[model samples]
Target: MVFLSYLFVLPVTLLVAEVALLTGATTLAGVSAVITFGLGLITVPIAAVAQGYHRAPDALSPTTAVVWHLTSQLWDVGDRIALEQRRCRLRSCMQRSDQPFALPRRAVFVFTADPADAHVRGNVTRSRARYLYRLDISDTYGQVFQRGIAVAIAGNVHATVSARRTLTATDVPTP
Candidate 1:
């Protein structure tokens, strides 16, 4: 978060230094400003790349890819903005549902699960086993929209389907 704040703050600092230099500031101060600006120029891109690299591994996950794709398709706002703002979260838990199996959405498979695990169940003994997952995208001011998903695991195979999507009341525009 500090790095992100630095990205926004550095430019304004540079602008202030430029103005001071033009207004007959001391040469020492001017030199210091130039050095600071030069360091910022080198560090900004490095910070940006490091931030991106942190998220890159998660982007390769099938679940993350499907969530992003679905957000682009079903969400009213731009997915890129949500992604760039880091407002998306993926959460999962083992659960049971009586709903019948539906066709899996394209590329929604995450991974196989063990059927014998009492906690996971995995739909092997009975078709009621499912993994419940939620994808949440929040607006700049903290209002959140959420999508619920169910991944049914049968033996070593698993498939995911959207269960529901909900927008927070604050997302509705005021009259």
Candidate 2:
């Protein structure tokens, strides 16, 4: 009981002192006196009886409490703003497409309408086992002419190359 009283009473007294100091009361002898007395009554009995509160209440540190509250509120607002931006960008992209082609569900071999025409147009090349299709696309023509539709189809070709490559490297397995 003595241990409980000293632990509880001393810290409550200090907290009251600190609160009075922060609020700039003229003395510890007015309305501030009544407030701190009420706070002591509430805190002292609990600290004496509860196993958890054998010492001063460490749960209400001012700095950590303020930081956690501010961080949570800021994250909530930021996430909503990010979601709205993504929705707006998606809508804008959809509006720009002349006739948007639906993506294919499964992979399949794509053949040009005419192999001879593809070869003569210099758009198709054949090696030992595969044929490749190629096209040069820029942003203005790609969206305006619905070139994504043709590119999407050509993407299914066995070995398409759209750009020039000077050198290539890959990890080779050692026997």
Q: Model 1 — which ten-residue stretch has the worst lDDT?
A: 98-107
Clashing pairs in 2: none
lDDT leader: 1
lDDT per model vs. reference: 0.33, 0.28
After superposition, which runs of candidate 1 have C-alpha atoms over 4 Å from their true positions?
1-26, 54-161, 170-175
Clashes in model 1: which pairs?
none
* Cα lDDT over the full model 1: 0.33
- Candidate 1 lDDT, 40-137, residue by residue in tens: 66554544433221111233245333331222234333223222222222222122222112221122222222122333222221222223223332
